[model samples]
Target chain A: MKFSDFFRKKSSGDVAKDRLKMVLVADRSACSPEIMERIKNDIIDVLSKYVEIDREGLDIKITQMDGEGEGSDGRTVPALYANIPIRNILERN
Target chain B: MGEVIVITSGKGGVGKTTTTANIGTGLAKLGKKVVLVDTDIGLRNLDVVLGLENRIVYNLVDVIEGNCKTKQALIKDKRYDTLYLLPAAQTRDKTSVNPDQMKQLADELREDFDYIIMDCPAGIEQGFKNAIAGADRALVVTTPEVSAVRDADRIIGLLEANEMKDTKLIVNRLRQDMVKRGDMMSAEDVVEILAVGLIGVVPDDENIVVATNNGEPLAGDASLAGQAYMNICRRVCGEDVPFLDLDVKKGFFARLFGK
Candidate 1:
């Protein structure tokens, strides 16, 4: 809203929160980014059998999402999010 | 029967012993019979923190090894008649006591005390397991730093895995002025990241160091941090006490005079 505010450096508190958000997701899931990369490759290898996916645009990450259903009570739970751009679906016999 | 509570922090020097001493003294001040158990084993210091080092004849190991009766080992506090201490063995390691021994010891202590606050050792090891062995609940202490909160999250996961689900978080040494200036994380921020219930938020006060040096707990003292600990004691007793408003700005004259 203010001209000078646009150039202000991000607060350290916000920086800590952001870093923790990213780190905790990996910690809770017990899946490091290196392991995630290997898993992503495996997924690509399997999915390539029946469909064509855009490898360049592929994205995958472990993140926090709101929970639903019994006993969840609107708690935030870790979820695996994937965005694989599908180029084509192959016809199966 | 008394409730057994363990004060733990996965990282060292985060105020676990100080919190234990203050909480135990605070509960005793409230007319509750309290016992502070130091489970740091070879690195025992709770006795020193509580100013009971000169009174230790028999310790936890002495009782566990049947060298002395449990009654013979407890050291009554000089300040509070209702408060006592079961100090850790300075010469023995954590393996000196097992989980079953700790459980039996806890059950025995519960019969006489209203609250048994155990000061757990730092790190997730045999010592940590021993500390939580007989605890009915846990209070995970952590500072606002990323490393401390991260270790606390790990400790929470470990506690849950052990089926110790009634764990709460205490954010210690929080600097309100720094938080206001966005140089430090607030208690709310730490709690949100850890996803645990907040029991207390203690400010970074020089009074705590002074009290530690003097071997006096600040729980019932006339200081802000002391008031915070008192509030935490009431909360532990199921009292619906509200948290202190630590965000109060300095008065004009105080700020002007740099008081």
Candidate 2:
């Protein structure tokens, strides 16, 4: 991060772009925030059987990434990203 | 057979009617036989916009319901010899017609006209479906606002799902000054977000209001928006035309000052 970044004000276009990016990701995936929350809870329940994890710190979001394959034309495709903070593995004897 | 094109936007007040009027007249001016269809049904305004409201004896519903022949509803334009309008029924709503009826009407019109332009109503409802049913391609109109662009995106997705893969974009009411000041999204920004081929970019001009009020199209007129619409018409006909330089005045000023 640059020192000037903290002080520089963002343009309205920048704000619109950021908001549009997030909204479009959700729209394209047909997944709302509520749906994402349900999926997150399900993931936490399943992961509890194998390991101990920090539920509060875990994050899951739908975002966009560069598309691949035929006819992509450098367009972006929706992707699901998840970050799980693990504390320890459960020992199965 | 003629080409049917639908001028549509998911949101209202985004110039779909005006674009239809201008492009249909522009195509006629280029010597093609063109017919403009107002498919908005209840909230029909394309007739008023095209200055043919008084001549709407029979409307789309009249023809679809077999009350009148298709030729009876077609009102010839006052100025353009080759341009005609199939006005929508003011008394009827969108529910009076369906996609099958529209497709049949388009097929019937295809035998007579070289180009058929359908002015679609706002929203992704029955009206929109009816408008696009007979269209060979779509020209999705949108403003620079976030809401308009978002709706355009949704409309594009719907179009793709319906197997209408050939779609283009028209970014309307683009204010160059606001874009320069970073207050509004530019045409490039809109195109990038929509991910569609840009057919044209119409500048925010008061001449549009004057033209619409006078019940005339702005195509081929002495205004920036007119020229932009004309260019779009040519592009629709598969002709290669350069986009107008909206920065021309600023460039001229800079050249005069040698800056």
Candidate 3:
């Protein structure tokens, strides 16, 4: 209900798309965005790990739902939301 | 009636532009007059890939705003006798075009061309809607990677809500070596997840970089990846081409190599 209020202004199509994407992200990562936030916070705690992740460049993702056409709804989810671009390779190189 | 098919993906760099360029060329090669429109708007790269950037005089924005005739905005491909490209307005943003306007433009183009291929931008935003608005069907491109597959799934859900039922899937940039090693997901694994009819599986090849650099598509060649794309093109034309296993059994070195 609270989430719906935040997205009230969005069109039905947009809302559906948003929900589907977010949920799939959660399912894939097996971690909610909040969990990701905690992970980020913990990483920030270990200030001297090896290399610092520029928070701005911290891209974390999990495969929630992949484009599995019209049938076999929620068939076999790959169980991971795969993108979290850790660094700009070109910039580093 | 001419069909409008949007080449789209939820994530970026999964070869929506590449698919658009090649499938458009393939359709044209078969003698169907085709127009490939780049709907990425702000980040326009289709023109460069098709090698038609140097010839662009007008673009989709011009055609939509009535600033120029559709023919004037369209850059006909020099390579294929029947193919044409409606390049995006690189300077303009996505807001410059809307769904209604896009549908109008596609309708206008349909009168002459047998096929209209729209190269869609990444994400589920206004650009995606505009790219899909005029289309009778869509091709959602993704890679075997978890992120790309996730995004493709979201795109499929959106397509369904929008009532675009004829959506198909194109899994691009597949690493056959990784698949054989069980380090990466196989085509069967991806299709099982996405649940869409498989259109094609493109192996990630260095030749794609070379082909894009030279403004030529590898679909015409006999390379393994090239043959896969060609098979996809045929499937798009309603041909039933069985998919080849990218990780099928092979000799010693080949097994180690995943070829």
Stretches off by above 4 angstroms in model 2 are A1-8, A45-49, A66-75, B248-259
* Superior candidate under lDDT, 2 versus 3: 2
lDDT of 1 by residue, B5-42 (tens): 99999999999999999999999999999999999999
Give the distance in Å from residue B98's predicted Cα in candidate 3 to where it truly belongs: 0.7
Which lDDT tens digits does candidate 2 get at residues B198-242? 999999889999999999998988789999999999999999999
Instruction: State how far residue B74 of model 1 sits from its true place (Å).
Output: 0.3
DockQ of each: 0.74, 0.62, 0.03
Please give the distance, in angstroms, between residue A50's alpha carbon in candidate 1 and its true position after superposition.
2.3
The sequence of per-residue lDDT tens digits that candidate 1 reaches over residues A19-86 is 88778777889987789999899999999999999999999988889888997767678897899999
Q: Candidate 3: lDDT of B174?
A: 83
Please state what fraction of the native interface contacts candidate 3 reproduces. 0.03
Could you tell me the TM-score of chain A in candidate 3? 0.35
Candidate 2, pairs of clashing residues: none
| TM-score rank order | 1, 2, 3
True contacts kept of 2: 0.42
